[model samples]
Target: MSQAAADTMDNTHAAEHGGHHGEHHVLPYTVYFAVYGSLLVLTGITVLVSFAGLGKWSIPVAMAVAVVKASLVVGYFMHLKYDDRLNSLILVVTLLFILIFFAMTFSDMRTRGMIDPVEDNMVLRNEQAAEKAAAAEASGESSEKGEEAHHEGAAEH
Candidate 1:
């Protein structure tokens, strides 16, 4: 093999050579610049997002942007793009577990209104009490009615 071929082999070999081998692989300056540039751009985008009035959609947009930024860091800075299949499998499993957990949690939360009877009952009770209070006040029947009724009942008994 020519010197260029040998150099390329050495670079590729350094990745798989699992030992105290003196052979080292160095990243080019451009890679560093590219990673850092992406990071800066991500920061700028996050800042810009904070300034926008996206209403309820802002949270989803921010989360999507954050996931993209995390993927970039994992693929580039962590060198997962060049890593083995086992590493990717591990990452996929972790993400799957996270998804499952969040899915279950949200499902449970969505069904909470149906599962727990107290929330609707409490709201209905509050509305009924408010209506009754408003009706009583409108009819000029103040709290003294209860007292007067009790007094009249005691006198009759």
Candidate 2:
């Protein structure tokens, strides 16, 4: 076949088959809207949990919701779910490493006072000081009230 005919045949073959080596996953508009709605709902949940007074669990809860939103974005919007296995594996490995790093950091934070007692753990000490000041002020107020009563009795006489 001539060169022009060969080029035309390759183009026709690519068109007949999937475009760009079948790597692309053409998603519908509905799928994108669904993912977007899910993300919005998760965001609202995160806000509610913040106001719900989870206290120490607040950070973990927010992080969990964020991870879910990220997964949806990666799998649907980025099309990593329909992507190559190798690409997905790379993402998983990266996340695992990140998890390990954060775990080590938090463990270190928790174990800081092991070698020596932490001197600046002042929450209890501050509360004690406040209590002492309040007690002293209460006694002073009682003495002032006694003096006021004595002055009134002398004036009545």
| Per-model TM-score on C-alpha atoms | 0.58, 0.59
Best-performing candidate as measured by lDDT: 2
Candidate 2 structure quality by residue, lDDT tens digits, 32-75? 88889999999999999999998899999999999999999998
Give the count of colliding residue pairs in each prediction: 0, 0
Per residue, candidate 1 scores C-alpha lDDT tens digits across 1-157 of 2553464455556556554145344545565567778888988898899789888988998898888888878866776654554788899999999999999999988766544265545455677877976787688786788568668989999
TM-score, model 2 to reference: 0.59
RMSD (Å) per prediction: 11.0, 17.5
Tell me the TM-score of model 1: 0.58
Model 2's alpha-carbon lDDT is: 0.75
Model 1 spans with C-alpha error above 4 angstroms:
1-25, 116-157
Task: Give residue 22's error in model 2 in angstroms.
Answer: 3.5
**Model 2: how far is 18 from its true place, Å?**
13
